[model samples]
Target: MNQYVALDNIRQELTLRTIPAITLWNRLEARPRTDNFDRALKAEVRDALWMLTKQWQMGEFRGDDAGSPVTSKIHMSTTKLSKYVAGNHDVQVFDDTVPLEAKAEQRPIPFTIDTQKVSLDIRLLMGRQWLKMIASTGNFKTAYVTKYAISIPDITDKNDVMVTAHREAWQQVAATAQRCMDGYELYIYLKSDAAHHAYDTIPMTPVQQDAIDILAGKFIIWYEKLYYQPLDPENNAWKPDFLEYQFGCSAPQGSGEKVLTADQYCDGHLDWYSVDIDPLSTTLGDTGVPVAPPKTYTRSFIPVPVTFDGMPDTRWWTFENGRTNFGNINPGTTDLGKLLLMEFGLVFANDWFLLPFTLDAGSIANIKGMSVTNVFGERYWIEAAGKGLDDDWNKWSMFTLNTKGNLGELTDPGLLVLPVTPKILESKPLEEIRFIRDETANMVWAIEHTVPLMTGASKRGSEAADELRKRYQQLLDKDISDGTVVSPVPVYKADIRYQVMNGVPENWIPFIPARMEGSNRSIRLQRAAMPRILNGDAAKPEKIRPRTTLLREGLDIDLCKPYFINEEEVPRAGTNVYQSYQRSRWYNGGVCTWLGIRKQTGRGEGHSGLAFDQTIPVKKAE
Candidate 1:
């Protein structure tokens, strides 16, 4: 009688019947949601539980399948339990065949030990399996795929290149995965072959090693969550199994899908909170509507974006200011403006003016010195010298449109801006001078300029004694010719950039600018514009221009050095100097304003700086 029901048969009965698990569990005084102990433990429990239930439902152990109840030929050869038992009862038939003294002895088959505890354990395993199956069927849309290719040859440091790419992808996955599960550990193995059959033979650099360390930290958290539950030592079941030997319970099997009571549900949640709940919360109360834990835990290790204001991100975006003693300019806050580089040298006396003052009195030929090419490809020359026309530059002809407003124009003030790389000529011979038609004025001008003359030939001052200053300037000039300039013409590479605007499709973000917002700056783009080199005749030494702040705050001119003074009037011990060059409250004081410099002479290094109330030639950031 005790051997009648095998554990398998009892499991089948529990699955086939409609026994509520919670009800059965309550009746047996067992933890119904025990498998829901921790998110880490859920999947394993679910898997084992489901397998047990399915096996029971399929009647895997029935009759002989349950193992032979008795060893007698009558039972072993019989087809049914009733038939086998009936065969043993045939005493008269058996005695006639085996003799009067031979009698059949009967031994009862014990029932299999399948208890309520075992049934509950199976339910927990079922939950774990369900979770795993769901996880394996993860939804991956094309939109979420982060596959990208790198041009290996384009990168110089192979190690750095690979490390950077790996870091980038790791960050993306970590961030996205958090939204789903507490966190998931990913296995990443690098391969040199497409089949991933062979791994890279190259040694990883220190940087790569560091990147791997970072990734490992993030990866471990996920692995621990995936396999944290303690296995059943007695049953050898990875999930849950009630060990009858441990508790010594022997009730009939009973399990079902029943909703847990409020108290039970709360208890389950409490256990989850007790553990580090990877992505889920550890607390519960009426603080507000109970927000369920996030579906997953995202690795909170997103690398900060390359920025100009923050460390590592800030280094490349900012530059040094040219006017304020070469002060550091915070690109994070500086407004868009022109970066000017001036070049200055001497002009021979005869080469000072472009057109001859008295162009052969009545020459029919147009003056060749003042020709400028317009955007329409037509060349315009000024030949009105001494022919009922003013010699002044303002009185000369002016073309207002370079390319209309299309070529980086500003509607606020009509000024043309042209970018040109700087050059330094220390004492060179005559060469062809390259010139470009100014888009704003259509007038040809030199590329750049610098201040002329030595301030103190006798006693060297701190400012003038900067040897590296001159060397750095030389290096800057050398760099221009070495890479910036393309021979046969003056040209330079434009590496200007912009920021991506918000509200725009991510694919097109680089080309668009969103409505003004503090956060979303524009994207960057490259365009060819500035010229890098210049060609011209060798220049001669020239006198320094009078020093004056372009926009004076309140400096007294009378107290300042005169622009033109007789040498005899100067004291023997000293010479007159501009107030701006001196250390005074009024000199280089107050707010700095934008100014404009105009070419006063064609050949001479002459420019008259003028202050403007408004910005001109406001070119959009390229």
Candidate 2:
């Protein structure tokens, strides 16, 4: 039987396995950072990492699927609060696949079939761990304490169930959210120092506080709407209990003025007036009339920025209260300068990385890597040659239509050739070039690491021309037999542009080159390796990951490079990035230990294998 591990269970498992915590603070000390701003910024980065890990473990942070962990909670009128998951009602209490025996004589069953439903008591353990981690980060701690919730449950004058349910749900939500927050805290730590600076916000800024309030409101509302169900209907059952609870309705005093029906009023109190209700009358004595409350509110608060100094020079900053007065000092003195530089650097990198993908015209095939170098010099690897598109016919023209001429007249339809152009410009004349397979004995020419051709034509249009084209079609059909064909490109040292054309070589669609390479083979080698390195897949990964559907079906190499490299087989480290806040190596030390073979090209660039969330079938034992 296949068992799927739950996110919370995964977290607990990770906690048990790793001795030292792999948090942001610890990572900061591990990696070299020179500036004061880097030190302060490390804390925030740690928080982000912590938040990410915790979120992942708690099911609070979703991956590409974009699903929330909390499922829907439905409310119905009953004297007892009964929780029913919206769709989970279809789940069988016991496996129905097991046969109930029809024994003639009363014999003891061979296997135990206990039907007792064991309740899970994971709330306290999960909550305590999460709260402690989040509290380590001052920013997260502030957000949590300020926006914490208290449960409200129903009571039968003397017996309260709603109160208990409310408290339990609140505790559960808080615990899960705290884990997510801790993960985020840790994620920030794993990020580069420069990236941390760019998103740096004023510590505990009111805007941030307001954001926390909004999130708290949203999550709490989700919990109440999805997890909390009302048990009492009549006033005597739990009406008094609901109204008297400390965490009861936050609705205004006249919230139920228009709730004419008893049902509406009863549900309204429990649901905080979210139930249907008409607008109050706005006339002289109506509840909707504007009456100022006893308290007045104002938004005119200006707070100063806080600065912490760890530098030793006079040029450094001296703070009186929250304000800092920077005297003329050198670079190492004031923390402000470093913070400013870090922030600016982060912004620049963000712009560069988030730049939109723009298609370059001219040579689409070249940019997309559909062209390959063969013994015929550099040629666009066309898997199949079909009749060109007749403007009148939106469908593909038949290969036999090559007999048709330019203006509906029959002429020698010269072989409809697929164009392949090199993406380089060299002053030297084209001479002495040999495009052959590397590390193979045969004279077989594989287009961009594709399967070898069965036949190679010595002349362009001899008796072998027909045979070559036939072989090409055979390979084409075989490659594309499964599904859509995507083109492939030859290895290049630098980025070249290409435009795709007719589907060829099984799943491959062809493309025209944008910038043709120069006739220099040496130059091509440099460009080829550069792109491979940039892609986080070094020349040799200990284990080459299986090709994805796109790659397996022959997607254009250039287009697939980014997607493939991103889908590397490198395993993820288990420790939370924000674990440093715990002040224990057990929580943060091994956070990124799984990233053993780091790609040497750039910082923050590394191989990412298939994520844990992807579902792949496991082979069953006989």
Candidate 3:
């Protein structure tokens, strides 16, 4: 009930005063300003000679016939993206410089199915780490250990019986990489180099080919920076939900009958291209207006002066930067963008400008306007400032790219893209997952929140589902202490009282929504599953499924298929996604690596009390 104010300079409680002054105004004394005449803070200007007679009666020192822009040019065009195509494969071509978000969410190596299929314990753990690093460099044995039925044993034996006699050479490189895998799609999809299913077959030698080139170069530094690529399992093509792209530009020399398109691009960069999408420009007819030519360019710069982050200082009695307070801007009489951003920071911060220019990581440009030139050899040809009516949201623009034009057409001009990328590093995630939304259990759970394991390391998804339910309760207590184990019996009939569907933990999984196939109202989400009653074959239960590979996409085409997901990409604030392992170097310094996938937006909706019909009644013993 007693707080006072003003006692700064580190006296902790600096300002509290909610009416606690209590009359303490101390400035008492026998005064001492016996007239020194320098009372400080007044600084001249009391109409300094009527401000120099109104700057010579208003001609304000005359000096404005315009003359600043020295040298500029611009006139761009560019194009390049060459071809890549996703979904139904077959179009590839961008030759080679890598990035389209690391070949579309990474993964050209590291195979362990998230439906990229390879798994048979990743082909016998890459053929038992290529026969334990070429049997610790001694007898590079490859006689298919007595031709296929496999049995080499003595690499000092007991490494799990030389890994169960090379389990038929890792089940023939995971069945020849599930019969030569392939897949492709834009914002997600990748599965191609299953390390050529271990030397395209035939028990190889050269020290099991240089110990699988040092274990496929450490699964190219940790499974492409840690797993992603999973989408096009028949997700069809041509903008399979647009990681966006549209290429094909023309119009120079008799306009090739007008049409030069190219910037319908999507927002996934780090050296752009939408990883693949070009099958003869797949559809959007009238051939999406383009005839092919565009390349021009033309540089020439020099116009500089425009700065940002809290600027305001073109003098008018300057000395005011108490943190950019153009007078605490209280704009609201129908704020016209805060009255044109405070009239361009108090009068067009010196008519702002910059120029910039460069363009070449994967090209796209299209400027078509500049010329400038000033110091009065006089030139003035400017034109590309948010031009107009592409549906004019008061003509605004920033990184450009939207293209297809259409809304009452004719505005067209905006192109940009660059695609540069190259700055890399990443790491931390190794599988996160989130994906909430529950509406009190109406579906969407995902939730693993870091799982990874199979010993490549990672934990806490409730400690890996309580160490997978204590190794399935020590394999149901070593099958009940091995007494001719026969615990499978449930045939009840007396009013059918035996319970069946009710278990959950393998990290919460579920998803649900449904409807999309011929849309009776277009719905999406899908994924679903949550039964895991630890299959002792109670007529095949086991559903839990997800240990993170971004929610195991489609469990290899069939554990009942259905994956889906698009219901406007999970709303009510939730979706996250994680994986990680980037690296980067290129342009000859080499070192690239991959495994990307990011996704964001979550911190909302959750409720895994995922239920189902059940019973809890047992009174006989009491």
Task: Note the Cα lDDT for every prediction shown.
Answer: 0.22, 0.24, 0.53
List, residue by residue over 1-622, the lDDT tens digit for candidate 3: 8555455443333244434443455687766667565654556576678877777676656667458888888877766554444443443444246555555445433344442222334334434444454455455335322222222223222222212223343344434332322211100111254434333344566766666566545544443333333234332122313223334322222232222333333333532222222223333233232335667778888898786645776544556556667768899999878888788777677787798876656555667777887887888887867766556667875554443435454354535353345477787877787878888778887788786543234556776676665555455546656743455755443543545455656777887887877779987777877765654433355566776666665564546555667766668998776666776665655465666556667888877665556664533422
Compute the lDDT of residue 182 as modeled in candidate 1. Answer: 18
lDDT of 1: 0.22
**Best model number under lDDT:** 3
| TM-score of structure candidate 3 | 0.31
Q: Which stretches of candidate 3 lie over 4 Å from their true place?
A: 1-96, 111-359, 362-380, 385-392, 396-441, 445-493, 498-508, 511-531, 534-543, 552-568, 571-611, 614-622
Better of 1 and 2 by TM-score: 2
What ordering of candidates by lDDT runs from best to worst? 3, 2, 1
Query: Over 4 Å off in model 2, which ranges?
Result: 1-139, 142-179, 182-190, 195-199, 202-558, 562-622
| Model 2 agreement with the true structure over 115-180: per-residue lDDT tens digits | 110111222232234356434334454443333322222222112211122334334443544233
Better of 1 and 3 by lDDT: 3
Which stretch of 10 consecutive residues in model 3 shows the poorest summed lDDT?
181-190
TM-score of each model, paired residue for residue: 0.11, 0.12, 0.31
> Who wins the TM-score comparison?
3
Runs of candidate 1 with Cα error greater than 4 angstroms are 1-187, 190-479, 483-622
For every candidate structure, what is the RMSD over all alpha carbons to the true structure, in angstroms? 49.5, 39.8, 27.1
Residue 105 displacement in candidate 3 (angstroms): 1.8
